[model samples]
Target: MCLLLRLWPVLSLLLLAACDQNQVFEKNADFDSYTWTVQEKPAFEFEIQDTTQRYNISFNVRNASMYGYYNLYVKHQLFGPDGKPISALLHQMILMDPQTGEPRGKGTGDIYDHQFVALRNQQFRQPGTYKIVLEQYMRQDQLPGIMAVGVRVAKAENK
Candidate 1:
């Protein structure tokens, strides 16, 4: 009885941490060479069952400290379930501080993880599977130090 009581707090915390009620979909695409090439485009498909709920879309990036540029550029396109393009844009994510060259986002040792918001309070028009494609948009043919890229869709909290 004493041991169970002592472990109750720890068990409660673990249970709470496992709950992510807002998460709809999250997936990552890893690069074997730790390099992202312009020709390599990663696409993610997720189903939208509820059109009334607003969602927040984010891009996840994991890079090494050796990444050459302070900012990463990419082009993202969203396609509806009917295979029609909905929106497309070129976005920039800051990975490091420009002046001090300090790496941004969550990091341990040399690796850093960044989550940049692509869309907030977004609602789907239709109920089906939607696709989002990400393409590296850089001057170089290949970008080094980029380990993986991912997409996350979650329910937006009402303010």
Candidate 2:
């Protein structure tokens, strides 16, 4: 029982690290300006290997607790291998509950982290280079309280 207790923390850390190692591609863009403007579209480029394999795609956003709104809207654009536009989508993400005003995601001090799934069980039509661009769609000319934005693509686990 003592041995199990001593090694439990180490074993748990290893298990958590192992779980996160399945990411096919991940990229994060930090906004040094501390503001996300409509013109300041952040782009992430990644290559696809196997078109047949399905993957889960999500957006990670970090914002301060003082973020004035309970939700955020973003415009997403995807470009294909030939540099042609593939799809354009408007995504609405809820950051906090409207009724309670309670925040979502892991928080430390004033900042919170949120992961919104943009695509699930999605497969690329072709194996090639792809580009994803994101822009804030809020009414403000320069949105505040946004710290960083990221994209994580992981291979789907067999069900």
Candidate 3:
């Protein structure tokens, strides 16, 4: 009973550290075949319960070391709850260092994870469903070495 009591505080800290306090929505699409085709656009839909508060939107890219390009180009299209297009934009995310050619993400061996902030301090403006579609903008029809793609929406933190 003494040992159990001593470990309780450590165990509680671990559990609390694993929890995401500000995350509102997060989802991932895994590619079993490890390929992301241009036609296979992944769409992420999230609900906005409080439109008054601002949020930070981010994109998560998980790729293997075999990914050829040093950077990834993606096109994002956002739609409102009424199914109308809100905005569209293209973003370039650096995956590897240009000079050193070293991967620039958190990875154990070959697979690396990269998170790019797509939107910051942005208000949803509507308390309903919002959709975002992601498409690869590379010239190649199919992109390989991409294990998964994800979206994360979190409540903005005060500066």
Query: Scored by CA lDDT, what does every candidate get?
Result: 0.87, 0.81, 0.85
Q: Specify the highest-TM-score model's number.
A: 1
Model 3 ranges with Cα > 4 A deviation: 1-18
Best by lDDT: 1
Model 3, residue 4: what's the lDDT? 63
* Candidate 2 clashing pairs, residues 3+ apart or interchain: none
lDDT of 3 by residue, 38-116 (tens): 8888999999998878998899888888999999999999999999998889999999998888999876667777789
Name the Cα RMSD for model 3: 7.2
Q: Quick one: RMSD of model 1?
A: 7.2
TM-score of each: 0.88, 0.85, 0.87
Off by over 4 Å in 2: 1-18
Each candidate's clash count: 0, 0, 0
Evaluated against the true structure, the overall lDDT of model 3 is 0.85
